[model samples]
Target: MFRRTFWFTAGAAAGVWATTKVNRKLKQLTPESLAATAANKAIDAGHRLKDFAVDVRDGMAQREAELGDALGLNDQDAPELPPQRRIAAIENRTYPKYTYNRNEDH
Candidate 1:
């Protein structure tokens, strides 16, 4: 009698555990859950891509400087406009605006 009861209790516990696992898996497979998982993965990929681009840019700049140094190039000789001069150039630009009058030549 004790052996039979022990086996039955074990079987019932196993069944409950299996059902709980299956239900959890089914919930994860639902459309909304799947969409959320995909969105999270996509966001992770975008961040990885942006990080890769920044790394590539920094590496390119470093390599260019190294090559310039090997070729005996001088970067300091290049002319650079000052901030005030640049701003003055931009401020000197003119734009014209026109208004139409209904009473004028129709």
Candidate 2:
């Protein structure tokens, strides 16, 4: 009789726990809840990405400074390349005249 009572109590507790879990899941599955959850996650991811980018920029600047100091480049003026090697965005390029006929009907 005592063993039977113990088993009955345990089963009732399990049922209550399962029902609570299901209800919580159903609530989360609702459209509004899902959207809010997704938006929150997206905002969190955006913040993480922004942080990562800032860290990368900071590290890059630090590395550049270290390299410049090691190479004694900080004290000198930047060198200028010869005119032939320089390219300007406003410069126009000339393309070679071309002709191609790959069609057998040509």
Candidate 3:
């Protein structure tokens, strides 16, 4: 029984030492793996940027068509007034007011 217990303790110590050595090696190898991962991420970002640019161009074209219809202007016609100026020309303009101010006393 004593012999068996001694062997079991020794085996557990050896396993712990082997795991520590393997973990050290893995830590040493990780920086190169991280750099390669970053390079792959940059390549993916470039593809995403290209896709986003195309989406923005298509969205702008659709928005311009909708705005032209709403304002009774032809698609080819440039409006005499800018959008912000047109909004300001409308009646019953009221600025937003806060009901409560945290810093002010009631």
Best candidate (score: TM-score): 1
- For model 1, residues 15-93, the per-residue Cα lDDT tens digits are 9999999999999999999999999999999999999999999999999999988876755576776666434446667
For each candidate, how many residue pairs have backbone atoms clashing (under 3 Å)? 0, 0, 0
Quick one: RMSD of model 2? Answer: 6.3
lDDT for model 1 comes to: 0.92
lDDT of 2 by residue, 1-106 (tens): 9999999999999999999999999999999999999999999999999999999999999999999999999879989876786666865878798777678555
Winner by lDDT between candidate 2 and candidate 1 = 2
What are the lDDT figures for the candidates, one per model? Answer: 0.92, 0.95, 0.88
Q: Higher-lDDT candidate among 2 and 3?
A: 2
Cand. 2 Cα-lDDT = 0.95
Off by over 4 Å in 1: 79-106
* Model 3 lDDT at residue 54: 97
Ranking by TM-score: 1, 2, 3
Cand. 1 TM to true fold = 0.68
TM-score preference between candidates 1 and 3, better one:
1
Best by lDDT: 2
Off by over 4 Å in 2: 77-106
Write down the TM-score of every candidate. 0.68, 0.66, 0.42
Clashing pairs in model 2, backbone N/Cα/C closer than 3 A: none
